[model samples]
Target: MKNGHITQKIGFSALFGCMLITMFFLGAIIYFTVVRGIGAISWGFLTQVPRSGMTEGGVAPAIVGTLYLTAGSILFALPLGLACAIYLCEYSPRGFFVNIIRMSINNLAGVPSVVFGLFGLAVFVKFMKFGISILSGSLTLGILVLPIIISATQEALMAVPHSLREASLALGASKWETIRKIVLPSALPGILTGVILSIGRVAGETAPILFTAATFYSRRYPDSVFSEVMALPYHIYALMTEGTHPEKQTAIAYGCALILMVLVLGVSAIAVYIRQRQRIQNA
Candidate 1:
């Protein structure tokens, strides 16, 4: 018994140590980003366009472009992904083909972002003749995150109690009605979780947009979907790799990273808040 007790204690200590290490690394990243970037962040930095060959000025265009791309990706991906998930969970027959399709989606989710970028370049940029534009980039990102959304949504839908579905159908509601009125509502929180994750992924992705949309330096803001705009991730990369003035651009790059982090966190926090409130209401 003493030996068992000692073993349990050691196991607890190891798990606790791992948790501490994870937290330490996370905290270190946040701390360094803030410390290095905060100095460059200001009202002007947030609102003005870059100036003097991107050596000086703000990242307003990049911020706007990121927002545009993120929104476009969500809009493009959500409905289609949700529909596919619904069909899979509610209608797809349990068979070899269904399993194969599921496996394909899972594999697609694991595909490299760079490969998606190449695909976007070939399909959206070249074949479609959309050129290097926001539409092409947004579509590419939408496709990139589609697998994630579909997988999460499928899990969420499957998690809905079969009994609840039966009850809704038994109450004279049609299958579609049951799904729309009961199942979807019940699974919204989980769906939103997928959205939250997708937003983070979509916002941070540089590779997918590199060939399809991002331009190193664009003076004008994107006026339409066809416009090639500056994006934060690409902006930071350009600053670090291609800028003439190192110190200033480096500071600005850090600042851009900080802003991107904040944007993602802000959006995610809002999603989480909504999810929690939904749980409370449902409870």
Candidate 2:
């Protein structure tokens, strides 16, 4: 009895220690980012246009470009991803072709962002003749996020109880009708969470946009999807690499980092809130 009690105590102690370490690492990251970034952020800094070199200027254009890219990517990716998820979960039969499709999607998720950038440069910029523009960038980002969105959506659909589907079928609902009314509504919160996460990834990505969407110096907002835009990550990279004033450039990098962090955190908070509400409703 004493030996069993000691073993249990050891297991609990190990689990607690692991959790404590994880929390400490997370806290350290948050503290470093916030401390380095806070002073560089201000209303004027966010609203004003960037200046050449290390001169203090605002990041309005980069901010706007980031928003445009994120929105465009989400719009392009969402429908195709949802459709793929539906086909995989509801329609596709177990076969070699289906297995291949699933493998391709999973492999795509593991590809490096820089490789995606290279692919975009070759396909979108050269073959499609889109050039280095926002449209090309958005398309590339959409491809990058597709696998994630599809996987999440599939999980959401699968989470809906089989009994709910049966009930709808018994009530004379067609498969489409059952999915549209019963399955979709129950899965929406999870879908939204996936979208929010994808947005965060899209916003943070620098490599893919570097090849397709970004320009070195763009004082004006993009007038159309084909126009080259200045994005926050690109700005951060440029400042760190080429700015004459190293200190000021570092400050700019920190500022951009802070903004990106805030955007991601805000979206995550909303997802968490929605998930909690969903749990309560389902309960």
Candidate 3:
């Protein structure tokens, strides 16, 4: 027993050490980004359009585009993903067909981002003639995050106690009614957590958007879903890799990265607040 206790202590210490190291690296990234990017952030930077080959002016277009894309993707993915989770968790039997679907979802979640981009290009852009518009990009991103949301929501739904279902049925409630009134509310927090994670992933994706929706430089905000738009991730990539004015453009890239990070974090905070409130009310 003493030897086992000592071994457990060593294992825990190693795990904690690894966690700290991971956090330290993350902190370093944020610290460097802030140090380099703070000077470029201002009202003008946030609200003006890029000019002079993107060496002057602001990133307002990118900001608006990113918002549009993120919102569109969420709108497209949320309901579909939730419905899929519900079917898999509540309606489907544990058997061969369900197993195949679960396996496919897991595989899809592991597919590379660039592959989604290519698929989007082929299907949405060429076949559907979306032509590098926000709609195509959003649909691609929605597909990319669908598996994540479905997996998260399924886990959440499954976590609802089986006894709750049994008691509801015992009280003469139908399965669908019980799920709607009781299970859904109980599982909301976990579902929100999944949504938050999906938002983060969708917001940061460059590859999928690059071929489908993002432009290297766009002067105006997108007027419709069919319009091509500037996104922060693609904008940063362009500035760092394709711009002639490296000094000024690199600073702007850093600033864009900072803005993107803050945007994601802000969304995550709101989702977390909602989830916490849900848990409190449920409790």
Clashing residue pairs in candidate 3, if any? none
Scored by lDDT, model 3 comes in at 0.92
lDDT of 3 by residue, 143-232 (tens): 999999999999889889999999999999998999999899889889989998788888889999988999988898899999999999
Top-TM-score structure, candidate number: 1
Off by over 4 Å in 3: 1-20, 271-283
Weakest 10 consecutive residues of candidate 2 by summed lDDT: 49-58
| Model 1: per-residue Cα lDDT over 1-283, one tens digit each | 9999999999999999999999999999899889999999999999998899998889999999998998998999999999889988998848788899889888988999999999999999999999999999999999999999999899889878899999998999999999999999999888988889899889999999999999989778999999998999999899999978998899999999999889887778887887788678767
TM-score quality measure for candidate 2: 0.91
TM per model?
0.92, 0.91, 0.90
Candidate 1's error at 196, in angstroms?
2.4
Rank by lDDT, highest first.
3, 1, 2
Give the range of the ten consecutive residues with the poorest summed lDDT in model 1. 274-283
**Where in model 1 is the C-alpha error above 4 Å?**
1-15, 277-283
